[model samples]
Target: MHSWPTTTLPELPDTPARREPVRMFDPSRQAVVALTEPGQQRASMYVCGITPYDATHLGHAATYVGFDVLNRTWRDMGLEVRYASNVTDVDDPLLERANATGVDWRELAAQQTALYARDMTALEVIAPDFYVAATESIPAVVEAVEYLLVHNLAYRVPVSETVPAPLTPGAADIYADIQAIASFGEISHLDAAAMTKLFATRGGDPDRPGKRDALDPLLWRAARAGEPHWPGSGLGDGRPGWHIECAVIARGTLGDAFDLQGGGRDLVFPHHEMSTAHTSALEGRARDLAPAGARHHTHMGLVAYRGEKMSKSLGNLVLVSRLLESGYEPAAIRVALFNHRLHQDWEWFDTDMQAAAQRVAWWRTALSGYGGADPLVFLDEARLALRDNLDTPRALAAMDAWATRTLELARDGDDGVAGAAGLVSRGLTALLGIML
Candidate 1:
């Protein structure tokens, strides 16, 4: 059985020094918010994991790297963070890709998920405290759906007329009551037309038969012929929908009101909005659960390649494994990623890679044969920089300034310069998750 975190709520620290908070731009609030509460050293977070079809692209890496910094920053501040993420191991994209390649969906999901795990490890992303896959958490999903249904927040309807028949018993489309949640469209600020259009493109069948509203998202999808099935009391053989998967996994792992929720900027729309709505509705029905507020919602910026977004559809994805095979070290990739603000979208280029490689080389030479000093003093500058919304660029600049000073001192034959440089190098590696 998967071990779950204790349901006991976290307490705020009594000491003022421990209350020193880190601020971040919350997309939900549309302003900067304190991510850590005064007197609190515990954080709960959930990031939507990959579907594992086309796994671990640079864009994907960029998002995880941003959140990894969040995790690192919290820990650096002496906080105990419980982070959870869900793997959409049984989603439409996986099935479609598997069918196209004539491979079993299970085989494809396992292969790509393994690849993603390897890529995350290569990039030195901190593993989530509780990582659950969709297939693994189906029962939890069904339970949540049942909760929603009992509360009249969800209802079953006929499957999409678009999907040709031989639909199984539990195959009906279960829709969430999108209207029940206040501030439904506030997160994305998408107009009706835009929401409808985006929904159709990103996992919503706007034209599906019996949908209550144009924006009502699916909670449970009934099984179809030749698709994977999980037997359930009322959910039928069909699996959970994309949005519901995050809601259930997060609630099951992190409980009702987590400290933070993060994902790519693209998820700001139907995916995140729907997840929040589902959680909100569920919270309303369960009186014991806190009214999960508009908490700190952070999003990593989109990464582009050439003139366009690096998407699987574009066939222009720059995979992490591909870059590694081309002889670029993972440290170089980490440096390149931190070259910009985590929330800023930028294009990937050869110049970025070259500059990062140069930075890594410089650090290696500067710290060579240097007996280490207390890394705390050297890390203080980075800590300040990162406190300002994970300002990696500013932090990198600080490291650069220190490196220049160390080089000058070395040229002057100062005995203390080597130790200082070693301290700075180690601090950078620890803070940035990039090895020196």
Candidate 2:
């Protein structure tokens, strides 16, 4: 059994007094919104983890740091927050990469996971309350899938000795039914036509028996020779699909309902949408189960290089470990990333990182000579900006101003000004994990 924290959920505030704005990408509106939940004091978050096939890159760093800042800001606001990110130890990428490298899949997954943990620590990202691995949660995945089957949300397709090419049009009803839930589009952002095209490429031909729709994804993929497989109920001898692992882990760790669900913009469709659908199906069967009402918000930042997506195959990736190896300060990386708006894509470049390093150096120097000044005024302004849609650039600008003004006061030997600068530095270091 998984052990969860026994903390009580925070009570929602009465009358929804304009707490800081939350940045959200609503697929239905096709636009981003800066809003807050009514009466909710705490925020819960779940960001997808790496698939463990490649090194953790700048793209990965941007996503994690963006959320780390959000989590830090929320905690600073006195809200009890619980964050979770899962490790996808079992997947197609892991298996394929292991085979090509002639290494054991388990060893590769463990090595990459450890490297990721080291990188996250260097970036000063807070450790999630629940750091789950799919292999460890097989029982939970089975239980959730069983619940769905019992409730008629999921059905088994009989597979024969021979694997089919893809799914056929004959199984359209099952696919359509899965997509009808309220939050179906929250993940994929695709209309019916686009969805059909997208899934077709991954689907096998329907003429073969035991095949469903071409787009119908695997809730459980039957094990092949020499591949990892778990034996249990419903799924028989197979491994859980990529999407189902996340749904099962989230439901198992956070319970059926929680405050917030988050991930990169990439996961909105298919992965996130499918998870929502599965959960809704489960909820419909049991009265106690209901799709968690948390805002399925996504961040829009973390742009890739040269208009190309970051991928291991492309080999244009900048690994976080590599950056650290090159003597780049982790604090610089964190500040540069946090300086951008959460829902906007900020381009990655060498000069951008250099700028962040310079800024950190400037802040540290500015605080060396501080006299008592009202630090709260500066802290409050920055905090408010962060809460109001995660205006990181604006918040960073404010810090720059504080640094400039403090330097002016320090030069004139104003004891009060020097004191205030010290307080400001301390508060930022403590709250934002930005060390002077």
How much lDDT does candidate 2 score?
0.66
> For model 2, how does the per-residue alpha-carbon lDDT over 88-183 read when each residue is reduced to its tens digit?
899888998999999899999988888888888787777788889989888877776777666656666654444432132222111213633555
* Candidate 1, 1-436: lDDT as tens digits: 2312222222222322223566888766778888877678588899998888876888999999888887877876778889888889998889899999999998988888888888888887888889898999888888889889988888889664454453663357688888777767767777899999999888898887677898899888777777887876776766788998888788888887888888988898888888877888777832323225336688888888888988887877888998888888998898899998878788888688889889989877767647333334457767777788888988888777666666666677764533555556546655678777
TM-score of each: 0.91, 0.85
Error of 1 at 323 (Å): 1.5
State the weakest 10-residue window (summed lDDT) of model 1: 3-12
List candidate 2 stretches off by more than 4 Å: 1-23, 28-39, 160-177, 180-183, 186-189, 197-214, 285-293
Model 1 lDDT, residue 210, Cα: 78
